[model samples]
Target chain A: MMEATNAELYRLVLTDAPYVIGAYAILWIAFVVYLSMVLARMMRLEKEVDLLESAVSKRSGE
Target chain B: MKQLRTAIVLVAIGGLLTTAAFLMAFFTAEVQQFGTVTLEQEVDTVFPVAPDQFQPPAGEGIAYVRPWFSQKIFYFHVPVAEASFLVLIISAVFAIRFLTSKRAEFDTKSRIAMETALVFVVLTMITGVLWTRASWGVWWEWEPRLTTYFIMMLMMIAYFVLRNSIEEEERRATYAAVFAVVAAINAPISFMITRVIPSNHPVVFQPGMASSNLLPFIIGQIGMLMIGYGIYTARMTEERLRERVEIAKEALEG
Candidate 1:
């Protein structure tokens, strides 16, 4: 009886493993994607700032 | 500039804390045991089956399936949901401030806050859907809490769409602010409505969560808040820098 119950408990753990792992995996992916997007936008804005700064300096020099 | 640097550090810390919480949840947290239900007959779950239904009959006749894997999701789901609501409230607060002051800076703050809120809302929805599938054995349900949350998500999307449809800057800001305030008001209603109306959503805290569960949950919540704040501040910095560039371009043209 003890051995049968132990086997049942082990099986339950295996069955539930996927759902638990999947939730954590999806959350990590979501965070990474959001971070990547913000970084990309920041980079684009940085490039724009550089161009604008150069243009302003050229205009003042002229 | 200093604010942006601080935000970056916060983001790093938040990410690390959340990762640690995830590890602790799996390694340390106890598997939840909500009331027991006995299977009357053969159920097709991968979990070990009782050799006979009558071999060990539960007193209530309802069989508690093995403590679910879905319970694990609560750690992540609850935190994301809370963070999303907090960001939305922040957005609405800024909206109210913008309306009172009629300042473009406030409008900018409101808009960036709204953007951050949208990202968190979407994450909440994704996590909620996953929980629904794992817990309720369905991918989606139009149950009270679910339906209310769906409406809240739509209102969020609508807020942005409303902003886009308008051609004038100030008019767009005003309309978006109003929508944001409405959405913010609706958020608490959507949350509390489940209390008044009988709902299927699991009330996690009323019965009490295990202390083992609470540690990771509290850690996850703090980390999520920090991450939310970091995202908002980072976006605001980028937006402000873009505005500066636009001003520079205008000055050169003049």
Candidate 2:
């Protein structure tokens, strides 16, 4: 295998072992956090939709 | 009930096959011989494997022959990568279906498949990173294959991001499906362009492996595909049930 000339770039970024692992860890954590937020918002919207439907039903019955 | 039963059966088969492949890799595969080097060489001097044993130097263009068991990563890596792409395609298919039919079920299937693809894509990245570290002495490289997979990982994440940003159910489904289809198209092009473009990265596609090596790889591939299918089916069933429950609740309220 030919040595990549740009191997120095990797060496520079990975100077600290923790940083390299941390990059991946951070990305995953962010993704999960974002997903949870989305799910929560969806649940809230569903509840609001239900409330609106119920309110309309009550008005019709009266 | 029938779909659940089918899913269970598929998962069982996948589990059995994967276990068999794992055993075959460890006990049956022949050790791949990386060429030997003298202890006094400059390359060996820099990247010493042990205090006494001669090993190739790090970052030197020397190939350290990996043990037979080291090859097992190949089985795991390729299968996960293949499965990831397969699931991506399935997601795209459902996305297209949703776009055409405007059906909730299609959207549900697309989302579940995307979720499953994410799992496999992560596995592929992990295994690919390990393989690069072990074989190439680098934790990460911007080589064609690596770069392409990296882009793919990001694209899939972006799909989720796009989905999250949308508040409306139908609009979110439509946009995510469109993105999924585009991503599915891009991944193969990424792979192809990487291979075609000339670069310094080492290509490891050997002409042929011994039967022992081949057997495990084949088993692993089949097992992974089966597992992927099983996961998709299981998730789809769960989504269907959730939709049914949602409909029932709405009906009761009505």
Candidate 3:
């Protein structure tokens, strides 16, 4: 009984390797980018709060 | 410091177990055989039964059915997939607690758990795609498991999207918590429906597994759970620190 060869099976599977790899790579990159954006926004908000505090202190002093 | 120590310990143990599982999968588990074949020099040769001389003995199969790399992927894939679902459930539990108690800590825990689940879900999707591509001919298929996972991936992404769209902290937490519970509930149903409605995709789970295969799988699962718990704890600690910082800033302003 002749069955499907290993090479034939390998060929069938190998074609989709790139797609799988590409999908994962893209997801990881997106996650990192989103994290960076969130960090940046938090920093900006902190700066704004500091500016507001200094302004209020100066007004009260005046 | 105590929490940090716990996190480090859990991570270390998890890493060690994962490594051990990988080694066991390769060296200990029996190589799975597919079917009997008759060797022929001609590529197109097809026969019901090629002569005895052409056959390699019944016991002496090919060196390996699947490649070493493909088989290795299985260890990581199944573990991460299981961990992702477990974390999702944890997140939903926290979400329910938050809704009932209206406690900030529960909300924080839920959010962190969801984030951890997201990381594992992405890992699951990647490994799943690789497995499918290797085992089946196609890169993407609308099989039950794949479809359900794809839906889960989207739902998780949507949870984050919903979070970003909301500005108020408490409101954001509440809405996210609600959504998390709904998504979590949907996950199992998705799995069940998919399995019930059969498709072209092959069902790999058999009635039982050999001891060698079972051991590695269990080890991998335990390691994955520990790693997931560690990540959740670490993220929660970071969030607590951020909250403290925010409170201090508010105090200074007030």
Residue-level lDDT of model 2, residues B148-237, one tens digit each, is 778888999999999999999999999999999988886676556646887544343457768887888788778878877876776666
- Interface RMSD for candidates 1 onward, in order: 6.4, 9.4, 6.6
Off by over 4 Å in 1: A1-8, B34-65
Off by over 4 Å in 2: A1-62, B39-69, B199-206
Which lDDT value does model 2 have at A51? Answer: 65
- For B6-108, candidate 1 gives per-residue lDDT tens digits of 7788888888888878887878998765434454444444444433453564542234346666677888888888888888898899999989988988888
Alpha carbon deviation, residue B235, candidate 1 (Å): 0.5
What's the chain B TM-score of candidate 1?
0.87
Q: Which candidate is the best by lDDT?
A: 1
Candidate 1 clashes between residue pairs 3 or more apart in a chain or in different chains: B36-B64, B37-B62, B37-B63, B37-B64, B38-B62, B38-B63, B38-B64
* Highest-TM-score candidate: 1
DockQ of each: 0.41, 0.06, 0.14
lDDT of each: 0.78, 0.67, 0.70
Give the clashing residue pairs of candidate 2, or none. Answer: B34-B65, B43-B57, B47-B57
Predicted complex 1: CAPRI docking category: acceptable
> How far out, in Å, is residue A49 in model 2?
20
